[model samples]
Target: MAYLYNTGYSSGENYAFLEAKGLCSYIPLHGTYKGGPDGFKYHKADDCYTCPQGKVIPFKKVFFEKKNHTKKKEYRALKPVCVDCPIRSACLGKSAQEKKFTVTFYREGYERNNARVNSPRGSYMKGKGQSTVEPVLGTLTQFLGLRKINTIGIDQANKVMHLSAIAYNLKKYLKFTAKTVKSDTKAVCYVILNIKTLITLQIRLLTSS
Candidate 1:
């Protein structure tokens, strides 16, 4: 959901990014048309759509769902367009009528939705970029001695990147272990004034008294 904008690139660009992500799925906007109508179409009514050339592309059918499950959406070009499209040779991989594309959405809704929830605060938060995020990661590699790797292949790369990020966040979190108020805490420290009254009451007198 974070509005990270950039010119769309190839699947190779996606390969690099996918290596550095966890619980994320690719959502391709659209592939290159090799100079056609030069725009796009959105069928909001259906939470599905078509391309600029009127090729109907259904959005992921589920619209919303639990993680790890991908919805398949299909697209097919009109016969007329397919027959007459000058760039059809490059635009449609195979025959235009038989060609279709799929869209996978919401694989990492937990993090992506963070943007939507904060969007009301305006694009200021959105403007903050790698200058802020990457340096923190560097601190992890430098001071925490987490630098270097011993892995090969795309799968290992993806797993390492995800695990590294988790380690960084957990290290940052350790600095606040003495926190007095944290809903994210897994244990109650009521006697030390770090726990809520309701939780304390449950722990002390609920079944005991």
Candidate 2:
């Protein structure tokens, strides 16, 4: 179809799901401020992340969130890394402990979606959504059976939605076809009548002469 225009669509969720499915190019979203993970560099070979101050923060642990069942990797820098560093004030900003950053659940997907959201093509799609898709969805929800699905379970819900969509498309098709046929018929009748009138005028002129 056309570009997606979901105002309530979560970039994090979208990115994570798509990335997990290996559908899109993933790029992490970095914060431009001090104490942000974007300032750090990840070392795959070393199995750790390096801070802007050159401190090596090794992987501490991996934990799964019970609610979402997603795994999270935590990294922690040495306490001495922030101590006595010239830019420590700018990096830590008076935090008592050492620097630590977590690669949370859906990190890949969140990053990829974030990149798409900030890209030129993404922006164009966003604009198109505001102008087009949103209104269509609004119409469907308001006027069509899409307002609510009475079915339970994913399969039932999917079937209901498909039926609703079919109904809407059929309604639109009928209206469009009816209008087209009416206009075409009117045009043909007007042309035929004009031709017959012209022929009659020609015959009368010849008779009068």
**Each model's RMSD to truth, in Å?**
13.1, 14.8
Clashing pairs in 1: none
The candidate that wins on lDDT is 2
Each candidate structure's TM-score, on Cα atoms with residue i matched to residue i, is: 0.35, 0.60
On residues 1-209, what C-alpha lDDT tens digit does candidate 2 reach at each position?
22353434444455555556666532334443122287788776877878776778898988876787656778887787778878777777776567777676455455556667678877777777678766767778987737777878876676665556555655555555556555856655554544565546545544553
- lDDT agreement of model 1 with the native: 0.46
Q: lDDT of model 2 at residue 142? A: 85
Worst 10 residues of 1 by lDDT: 28-37
Steric overlap count per candidate: 0, 2
lDDT of candidate model 2 versus the reference = 0.62
- Poorly placed runs, candidate 2 (over 4 Å): 1-38, 65-70, 93-95, 112-135, 183-209
lDDT of each: 0.46, 0.62
